[model samples]
Target: MATLEIKEVAKRYGDRTVLHDINLTLASGEFLSLLGPSGCGKTTLLRIIAGFEHPDGGQVRVDGQDITALPANRRQMGMVFQAYSLFPNMTAEENVRFGLRVRKVDAAEQSRRVLELLELVGLANHAAKYPHQLSGGQQQRVALARALAIRPSLLLLDEPLSALDAKVRVQLREEIRRIQRETGITTVFVTHDQEEALSISDRVAVMYEGRMVQVGAPAAIYQEPTHPFVAQFIGISSRLPARVVDADQGVITVLDRALHTPRARGLQPDVALHLYLRPEGVQLQAVNGKDPQSAVLQGTVRESTFFGAVTRLRVELDGGQGVLADLSTHEALQLPIGIRVHVSWQPDAMRLLPAELPI
Candidate 1:
């Protein structure tokens, strides 16, 4: 395992700039994920780290050694792409041994390593099968085994499971995590799948248009997003128009409404603000009941959809504040559709975002 450091990295294609002053430090043996939408330069960043692409500026250091000038093959990095790039003619065992053979490892040691890796990936029995004889998931496992065979210092995965079916993707993702944990190799995984990043990564870097918008644990990024773009991108968070009517004593009044809540003090007053709340944070109650400790929104349930585990309701506030609330199926069993109910949320569940970003 090796520590990976990227400092002031920038990339450009002719006149168009793709990456700008990117800086990150990855701990050794950590499962870090680079997450973003398409064209966000995540793959470009990964290629730069793997020595497949060069940066126009800045440096890349691995294990305290500057490797910005090294070729991809000399960098001792393993890479797995979205497509399983396996040798078509060779059997699984032979394909995995290709790297060892290239380095002139003895036959006895090569056989032992191949058997170990095939067994490690649960492909020992299928070692004789060629790439065309395996399923998508099986082929990917073979690819992973082949990548690990070289004992590379860093493993770079670029959407390695995107080509699999939904069920296979889920299963293979877990398998990949298990393999990574057992091997303890420093890895960098790049993907556009938010759920995959949130579920698998020890730390996630949320990139946007070539810059990292947010970087933190999955829970922190989802619950306490520092940016509006992050709050809107990470999960199902709704933004309502608000203003900081009272910035003293850590209190703020929800503008256009009579609700008051405690917030971070020292924000500009009477300015436009966005109040973020997650779907699960909102609580629904019968119209006859009252909850004084909660901030209430009087709204008729505009639409309700059964989602097996949860029933989602779209509520439109009387003053035009729109929000969505999710109730568990068991909780919504007795409630009917179109029922006018009071929707409320705790004060702490609301997140505040700047009206105009300083950046």
Candidate 2:
């Protein structure tokens, strides 16, 4: 229910810079995710926002109030960590009531709030159970209920479901999203899992090495990545060598096969670039189709993997380059091994980025 803003935030540890000019804004009631690989400063940035760690520069504002120098407790933010750090001695209801008690709520109010929160998290029946008596998912639900007991202005989640089993993780993720939407609490989630971020966030900031690489809706970031690092980091895709053959008409040639460029406004001819095409975007053609304007590459099916719902095929181009294709089991059943196939993709599905990347 509050807008969070981080302006030009910088964090450092002695001589090493951990975060550099991280600028982001979260709309009121929006769920924003900070996503990146391990050691990429995603957690460091979350800590800074939570007021657990101070930034060297810039400001942290909540509802237009600068809270840069405020202590973690005074910031009035709720945090849920990867580990369910619940008190072992306290029962579920007692643990959820701790925050209200700390804030000096009356006994009657605390009891009502704790019960409501437990019910909200679907743990009302287990209110009398201790931490050791509950499963990992149940423990995390208790943690969430406790965090909500405070009714803080912002909710910060650092891989809150990472420790749970896969089935529990999926269920808990939906539960968390439902809770957030119902409460309308502004949330900042940090995770290294790309699928988790893409599936749950209203918007995501893709970070790399202490810098924000790209920030956008999941669809935009996945379909039209602006940088090679962003494209490679966000999802599975093939990057093929290409040349700018026509700058005016947005044309690029790959392996002497010309294809229309994907909205490269200022590209120059003979420049080296990369064409990013995802596996799902490529289609297998046994023979030439009627789409004359489309560019197709003939490759031999090198390997195929059957994965129940879908099958994956690896095709080797004439130049020895490889492209991966994913098909449903029914579609894959039509093709066999060592078959020469033409791989075709829509022009708009192609994403272009500079071939040479920094690091």
Candidate 3:
């Protein structure tokens, strides 16, 4: 329902800084997620956006109107916390109508809105149930309904699904996405769960320490991370040591095989580098013949673990380094432990970075 702009937001407590010149924008009706590990300032940024925490610097704008100095209650932002903060004495319908009652809405309007919200969240049949009578997922649905009852301009979800069971978490997340889509309320979700963020968000902003390292669509963030930290944080990758053969041409030599890669800024020839390869990108072949165009490294299968449709193999390279490879169950079953094999991947499937690059 509204566009959000955060410009040069900075926050600090005592001698430690929690946020550093953070800038982000969200289009109207867009679901943007702030993803990071603990103490990464994601929750701080969310609180700032909701007017719950005052920033030391920068401005927050909604539809070009500066709301940086506004109090939390006047910001028209609805918040759903990880804990379902429902009134234990109140039923679902009463809980959903609490906001409307506080706003002095007429009794008829409040009743109608309560019924509408309960129906919207698929809990109309359980409107009379108290907090103790509802499951975790049902409690979260009530919290969501209460947040929406005010028809806020923005929604802030601070790991709203963290308290639910795994199966219920997945179900509630899908339901939240559906509700967000139907209402078209601009939302900012803060979470450390990568799968939850990747599955539900239109864009993901990965943060580290006190800074945002990367922001992109889920697929782009996962497939082509621009920073070393982003590459390591977004998913699992095997780092293999290499040496730059040609910086200008983006060439590197790994396991005695020269391979071409995307040019990295400030890289010099002969310098040590790291080649990051995703598990899915590495292929296993029985060492019979070599492909002229492929970059292959000889290794022996050290261990293989079957995982339903796919099997993950830990291949130890000749020099004692290890790389993971994922193969179909049938293909992996053919190569047991101690089986000599060749591990190869396309040049473009790996990212080459300076070995000294700090994560």
Worst 10 residues of 1 by lDDT: 249-258
Which model is ahead, 1 or 3, in terms of TM-score?
3
| Residue 326, model 1: Cα distance from true site in angstroms | 1.6
Task: Output the TM-score of candidate 1.
Answer: 0.95
1-359 per-residue lDDT for model 3 (tens digits):
99999999999999899999999999999999999999999999999999999999999999999999999999988999999999999999999999999999999999999999899899999999999999999999999999999999999999999988899999989999999999999999999999999999999999999898899999998888777777778888898889987778876788777766675434787888778888888988877675434637888999888899999999999998999988899989999899888788765568876677453
Model 1 accuracy (lDDT, Cα): 0.87
Please give the ranking of all candidate structures by lDDT, highest first, separated by commas. Answer: 3, 2, 1
> Model 3 — TM-score against the truth?
0.95
Candidate 2, TM-score vs. the true structure?
0.96
Quantify all predictions' global Cα lDDT against the true fold: 0.87, 0.88, 0.91
Give residue 205's error in model 2 in angstroms: 0.9
Residue lDDT tens for model 1, 1-359: 99999999999999988898999999889999999899999999999999989999989999999999999989989899999999999999999999999989999999999999999999999999999999999999999999999899999999999999999999999998899999999989999888889988889998888888889999898888988778878888767877776677565555366565666477788778888889888887767765545545677777788999999888877777778888898877655766777777866567989867633
Count of residue pairs whose backbone atoms collide, per candidate: 0, 0, 0
Question: Candidate 2 residues 1-359, lDDT tens each?
Answer: 89999999999999999899889999999999899989889999999989889999999999999999999999888999999999999999999999899999999999999999999999999999999999999999999999989999999999998898889988998899999999999999999888889988999999988998899999998998987888999888987898888888877788778766546557877889888888887788664444433436878888999899989888898798888888897887777888877888866567878898754
124: Cα error in model 2, Å: 0.3
Deviation from native of the Cα of residue 60 in model 3, angstroms: 0.9
